[model samples]
Target: MKAIFDDRQWHHDPKHFMANGKVLPSPEQPERITRLRHGAEAAGCDFIAPKDAGLGPIAALHSPEYVTFLKNIYTRWQRIEGAGEEVIPNIHPANRSDNYPKSAVGQAGFHQADTACPIGKGTWEAAYWSAQSAVTGADLLADGARAGYALCRPPGHHAYGDLAGGFCFLNNAGIAAERLRASGLRAAILDVDVHHGNGTQGIFYDRDDVLTVSIHADPARFYPFFWGHGNERGAGRGIGYNLNLPLARGTGDDAYLKVLDTALERVAAFGADVVVVALGLDAYVGDPFKGLAITTPGFGRIGAAIAGLGLPTLFVQEGGYLCDELGENLTAALTGFEGA
Candidate 1:
């Protein structure tokens, strides 16, 4: 497999993360790239740097104004008289139905869905490059690669078309699916990340062309509390297109794979030409977040099952914190896919 990556992705180094009523060092750090790179190389993946795709690919999934906001938000936040080092929203609209705000503070709240995604000095450049990595992977898949991996940092499944959240500024999975669809292929995104892929789900919720499905921790007591319920089948033309399979907290491998069997069946029924796996290793048992209990070997089973679908696959990196076996977990999945 060819693994696409960009060194610029390390530029957005987040410092603080608000959790458990206290601000502490964030789990999303630059070291993640080092670990992920080691895993890709160990998995026998050929590393390739992404080219400058410009804003066209990303703009296709994100609004122009929202993209503009991300590019310039850090500079605008720095100019504030008493602004913090990073842009963290202090207030959010009771509902997003209101008009957009003019002030940088209000814009922060408007564009940012939570405090987890703080915009630092190099956030724009890093996020832009991270997105390009995913786009490049899609380009490789479209050009006839059996499979491709995008080592995207500041993982993107949590980002909405216009909102940044959960350390994700740009939705890489959504961008990859969109690019694949533009290449005349029916694309389906199967997000196996521990958290619901709310951003990817929201982007394709109304479109039947790019089918979106997520299997994650039950949202009733999870990070993305708003969406990811099983009943959120797509609406309008997209009805029955979106699928959410939320599992209970502490669910382990055997049970997880059983659910995955059902998810793959849905993909097969959809007749998707290609698949994008929103790969997240945070579901590991030792993960600091403690959301699920998927073992390292379990990831191999997950990968093999996805490969069984026999579709050209794009593995886009999502959330996985600093763990002792982080590299091994990632490599295990890719190895499983290759072996299968």
Candidate 2:
């Protein structure tokens, strides 16, 4: 299998992450690429630097304003006297429907969904290349590869059309699905991340062409507390097109696999021509989040089961943090898919 990545993705080294009323180092670090790359290579994936797909593909799903904000926000924030090194939002509108603001502080709050996605000097470049990597993976599928992997760092599933959250900026999996859809294929995104793919769902919520499904920890008490409820199905023409399987906290492998079966069945019913797996290894038992208890070997089984769908698959990296088994789990997933 071919894996898509760009060295520039290592540039977005975030420094601040607020949790439990205290600030700490961000988990979305550059070391992630090193481990993931080693894992993909172990799985026999040949690495290829992604082409500069430019803003056209990214702009397909993200708003132009949001894209511009991500690109220039860091520098703009620097101009503010006594500004923190990173651009973190301190205020947000009561509702997003409120008028857009001109102040840098208000814009930061407008574009950043939460403090987790801090905009550093290198964020825009890294995010741009991470998205291009996903686009390149989709291109590989379009050109007839059976499967591809995109090692997207500072992962995406949590971003929205105009807001960044949970360490995500550009929704890589959503962008990949859009790329496939534009190529005249029916794309279904199966997000297996422990955190619900709120952004991906939001991006496709009003459209019916692409199907979105996520199996994640129930949001009632999870990091993304506002969305990911089972009843928050798609709206408009997309009604019945989105599926959310929110699992209980501490859900283990066997139960998780059962939920996955349901997710795949929905994808099958959607009559999808291709599947973009929003692969988040954070669901592993050893991951720091501890949302799900999927063992390292469970990842292999998960990969094989997704392969059972028998569709061209593109695995876009999501939310796996640092752990001894991080690289091993990724290797297991890719190899299991290939072996299946």
Collision count for each candidate, in order? 0, 0
Candidate that would win on lDDT: 2
**Candidate 1 lDDT trough over 10 residues, lowest sum:** 91-100
lDDT of 2 by residue, 1-340 (tens): 9999888888998999988999999988899899999999999999999998789999998889998898888889999999999999999999989989999999999989999999999999999999999999999999999999999987999999999999999999999999999999999999999999999999999899999999999999997999899998899999999999999999998999999999999999999999999999999988999999999889999999999999999999998999999999999999989999
Q: State the displacement of the C-alpha of residue 255, model 1, in Å, after optimal TM-score superposition.
A: 0.6
Model 1: residues with Cα > 4 Å off, grouped in runs: none
Q: List the residue pairs that clash in candidate 1.
A: none
Residue 250, model 1: Cα distance from true site in angstroms:
0.9
How well does each candidate superpose onto the true structure, as a TM-score?
Answer: 0.99, 0.99
* RMSD (Å) of each candidate, 1 decimal: 0.8, 0.7
lDDT per residue for candidate 1 within 59-137, as digits (tens), equals: 9999998998998988998899988999999988877788788999998999999989999999999999999999999
Instruction: Report the error of model 2 at residue 61, Å.
Output: 0.8
Off by over 4 Å in 2: none
Model 2, position 174: C-alpha lDDT score: 96
